[model samples]
Each structure stands twice: as structure tokens, then as C-alpha cells.
Target: MIDSDGFRPNVGIILANPQGEVLWARRIGQDAWQFPQGGINDRESPEEALFRELGEEVGLSINDVKIIACTRGWLRYRLPRRMVRQHSHPVCVGQKQKWFLLEMLCPDDRVCMDRTSSPEFDGWQWVSYWYPLGQVVSFKRDVYRKALRELAPRLLPMQEPASKHRKEQQVSRRRRQERPEC
Candidate 1:
């Protein structure tokens, strides 16, 4: 719902695998990609919205994941002026989100992007936890950095065997460098 300040209450999901990578989905028909997120319906708590959006967007359920962490409060980002809908009632200027970090318990094959009639994403892949920082739309990058930074500590334990983690980081950096930016 839109708040008095003209921001929509929303929930953002970061679904992480055991390897510490997070789910990155392509916007339905666009080259642009992002984490799964949706607005919180009236009278619904952020946690409720998280799961609902999780199922609707990624085809996952409560049984398929464990809630690892969440932002203490909302992280906000403003919409680029051209994207704002001036004619809408209460006109949302941006979104204020409660970001959630969920650890996937189900197998990878279980993720179904087309589970809903109208899917939000057409394709998906797992990427290094920090990859989205540079890839997300610029307007939301700051909030993404804040949420990922705050929730990252909880994923640290999953990165055990320091030497291996270090090696992975080295490889990840090399690949990221080889890939061209969008």
C-alpha cells in the first residue's frame, strides 16, 4: 500500500543457495534482472508478503526455504522521475522495502519461473552474492547495497573452510572481470 510519504510498502527476497550464491532473475521480457520483490498488500505483515511474493515470483514455499535474516526496518529507494506515474492516486514516489534473506532447502529443479499465469521472470540463475550491486538498476543499487551488507553476516558461516572460500572469491572476481557490463 502507498504510505503518506508516497512510498509503497514492499518485501524484497534474496534466495541463497548452500554455496552462498543468490538467485538472480530476468525481468519477464527484458535483459534487465533483479531479485524477487513485491508490494505488501493492505493488512499484511512484511513477513507474510515475503512468502506470498516468494511463491508468486519464484514458485517456492515455506517448506522450501529457511528465513536466514531480514532488515531491521525498511530500506528505501526513489523512482527515477520519468518512471513515476503522476496520475495515480496517492502517487507512489518510491518503495520502502523489508528485505529478506532466505536459504534454499529445496533442489534447484524445484524453482519454477512459469508457475504463475503471468510470471515476473522468464529465466533465472544463481550468482555471487555481491553481483547484483553493479547489475541492478542504478536507482535501487544503494538500498541493495545496504540490505546485502546488513544481511551478509548471516551467510558468512556458510562460507566455511576459509581457503576454499578465498579461492572461490578469486575465481568469481576473474569471471566478473571477463564479463561485460550491461
Candidate 2:
């Protein structure tokens, strides 16, 4: 539900494979790709909303994933003025999210986009852990960066310094490829 701060209460899921690559999904008919996320119902807790959204958006249940870590408090970002709905109740200016890091326990075949009547994504793939922050919509980038940074350390033996270093290098290479050579 939208809160008084003009932010919607939401949950962000960072579902990772055994190698630490996170699940990235493409929105139906749109170029945008992001981790699965959804609003929290008025009656549901953040954790409950997370599990529900996970299943609805990616066909995963609690049994299919192992919770690795979650944000300590709400991580928020503001929407640009043009994107805000001035007439809406609670006036959601953006989202205040509780991010969760989960490791896939089931086979990749279990991940489906149409498990629910209204699917949030049309296709999905596993990408490096730091990939979403750079690829998500600009407004949400900061929050994604913060969430991943905070949760990365808790991801256990997989989050070794060498792995993190490799991920950083990969991100740098991608950024270079996206920019035109001077």
C-alpha cells in the first residue's frame, strides 16, 4: 500500500542461481528489464508480499528459494515529477522497498512467467549480481545499487572478494561497450 511519505510499500526480489548470478526479467512488450518486484497489499507484511510476488512474477515459491539476506529497513527512491500521479490517494511519488536476496533451490525449468493470470515479465535469464543496478530504469538504479551492496556481503562463500572484483570488471566492460568511442 502507499504510505504517507508518498511512497508505495514494495518488495524487491534478487533471486540468484548457485553461481551468484541474479534473475533478470524483461517486462512484457517493453525494453526494460529488472528484478521481480511488486507492491505490498494493505494486509500483507513485506516478507509475505515478497513470497507472493516471487511466485506471481517468476513462478517461485518459498520451497524453491532459500532466503540469503534482506535489507534492514526500507530503501526508497523518488519518482520524477512527470512520473508522479498527483491525483492518486497516498500520492505514490515512488516506491519504498524491502529488498530480499534469495538463492534458487529448484531447477531453472521451474521458473515460468505465466504462472499467474497477470504476468509481470515475459522472459527471464540469469545475469551477474551487479547487472540489475546498471540496467534497471534510471530512477530505481540507486536503490538497486544500495540493496545489492548491502546484501552482497551476506551471500556467504559465494561472495568472495575475487568474485566481487570480477563482477565489477564485467560491469565496467559493459559500460564501455554502451558508450560510443570518442
Candidate 3:
């Protein structure tokens, strides 16, 4: 479903727990982490693709999570130069995603990364909404921030301004401890 602008039709899933922490997963065979996202087939709507992607990537069924809200329209991001697949038809240089925010009603243990033969992710964790904005691949950082910002009002009221400060402090402290001193 590549559009005329060379963007693929896709769905991005932001599955959050009761505490407002979102699910982040490490891409298979890679350390890069991101929200679960997949292409939307011609036959399926964005919502349908979201459920299918949620199931495929996180072993979650529609019953396991409730859709809280979605971005009003598509949010897009370009692939980094090295990551683009120029040989593919339509020369898809990016993805225009309809981001879906889902509330996970099932227990965290129900998250199974290896549900399919070719899994999209290898591991997962729950992190604050803004965490991925700083940590996701550079090309995606802006889109991630935009999606989280737009859909954030629908999330639980835990993302107070002070919470952002606390998280930043936590990250700074962790980084300081992680670096070796001269």
C-alpha cells in the first residue's frame, strides 16, 4: 500500500499499561527499540492492521487490549538514507502511519515476543511515554514524539510535568553511572 508520495500505509501501536507506561520492544536481531508497527494491507483498514500488528508483534488479541484513541490522521517519517529499500516497487522511502493508542487489559506476562516463526521483536519493557522520543532511532524520534504528544491526553493522568523532570533525572543519573571515568 505505498502511496503516490512513496510512503507506505502503516499502523503504529502504542500499548500502554494501567500505569501509563508504554510497551517498547527491541527489533529482532537488533538493539533498536520502538512501538509495534506494521504495514496496512489493501484489504484491511488501519484499525484492522493495528490489531493484526498488535497480535503479531506482541501476542495480543483485540480482547487483550482496548483501543483508547488514534491520531486523527496519518503521521509520517522518512527512512534514513542507509535504511531505504530503493529496489522495492514504488520506492517506498517512508511510512505514513495511523498511530493507535491501546490500553492493555491483560497481564504483562501475556506478552510473548516469539509468537510467530519470524518474530518482529525479541524482548520488551514498559517505559514512560517520552522515553522513546529520546531513545528511538533518530529518523523516528520526531514522529514518536508527535504521536505520543497528540494521543497523550487520552492516556492516564500520570504524565505530569514533574514526572518528566523525574524521568530526566533518572536518565541523567543512569548515564553518569554507566560512563567510565577518566
Candidate 4:
């Protein structure tokens, strides 16, 4: 649902495999790739939306994945000017997402992107935890970085020094600038 601040209530999923890699899916017919995510319906809780999206987007049911953790609060990101739907009623300026980290309990063969008549993704892969930071759309780079960084410790140990972490973020930001928006 769209909130007073013009941000839509949404859920972002970060599905991680046993080896510390996160699921990254390519848009049905586009170069864009991202984690499984969807809006929270009018009466649905953040978690309900999460599970629904898990099945809709990735064909994974509740039994196929286990919830590991979620961001303590909403993490938001704004849409670029051209991407905003200005003509829609109660215009959405961006998304305020509750990000969840899920551990995959099913095998890779179980992922079916075309479970629905129309699929959100056509291909998928397992990528390093930090890969999406530099690869997601420009407007979403910051939010992705924040969500991944916050939820990562629960999935894997964070042994890097703070300085190294800062360095990695700086590098991810620079790389994000060089990538093209999809």
C-alpha cells in the first residue's frame, strides 16, 4: 500500500544458499537482475507478502525456504524521475521495504520462474553476497547495499575490519556508477 510519504509498502527478499551466495534473477526479458520482491497487499503483513512473493516470483513455497532474519526497520529508496508514475492515483515516489533474508532448503532444480503465466524472471544464478551492490539498478543501489549489509551477519560471519568494510562499500558505490540502468 502507498503510504502518506508516497512510498509503497513492500518486501524485499534475499534468498541465500548454503554456500553463502544469494539468488539473483534476471528480469524476464531484460538485463536487469534483483532479489525476489513484491508489494504488501492491503491486509497482508510484511511476512505474508514475503511468502506470497517467494512463491509468485521464484516458485518457492514456505517449505522450500526458511526465514533467517529481516531488517530491523524499513529501508527506502526513491525512483528516478523518469521512472516515477506521476499520473497514477496516489503517486508512488518510491518504495519503503522490509527486507528479509531466507535460507534455501530446497535444491536449485526446484526454482521455477515460469510457475505463473507471466514470470518475473527467466534465468537465475547464485552470486556472491556483495555482487548485487554494484549490479542493481542505479536508484536501488543504496538500498540493496544497506539490506545486504544488515542481513549478512546472520547468514555468515562478519570478520572483516570496519575499515575493510568501508573500503568495500566505497568500491561498490564506484562500480555502481559505471553500470547501466535497466
lDDT of each: 0.89, 0.84, 0.85, 0.87
User: Per-residue lDDT of 34-141 in model 2, one digit per residue for the tens?
Assistant: 989999998898889989998899988989987777888899999999999889776889999999888799999999999977787899999888878779999999
User: What is the per-residue lDDT of model 3 for residues 1-182, given as tens digits with 9 covering 90 to 100?
Assistant: 78999999999999999888999999999989999999999989888898888888899998998777788888999998888888888798999998988889999899999888999899999998778988898898888888999888667444445546776766654543342221
lDDT of 2 at 11: 93
Q: Can you tell me which runs of candidate 1 are displaced by over 4 Å?
A: 158-182
Please provide the root mean square deviation of candidate 2 (C-alpha atoms, Å).
9.7
Q: For model 4, what is the error of residue 3's alpha carbon versus the real structure, in angstroms, after optimal superposition? A: 0.4
Q: lDDT of model 1 at residue 51?
A: 89
> Which residue pairs come into collision in candidate 2?
none
Q: Clash number for model 1?
A: 0
Q: Write the per-residue lDDT of candidate 4 for residues 5-98, one digit (tens) a residue.
A: 9999999999999898999999998999998899999999999999999999999999998887788899999999998999998999999999
Per-residue error for 43 in candidate 4, Å, reads 0.7
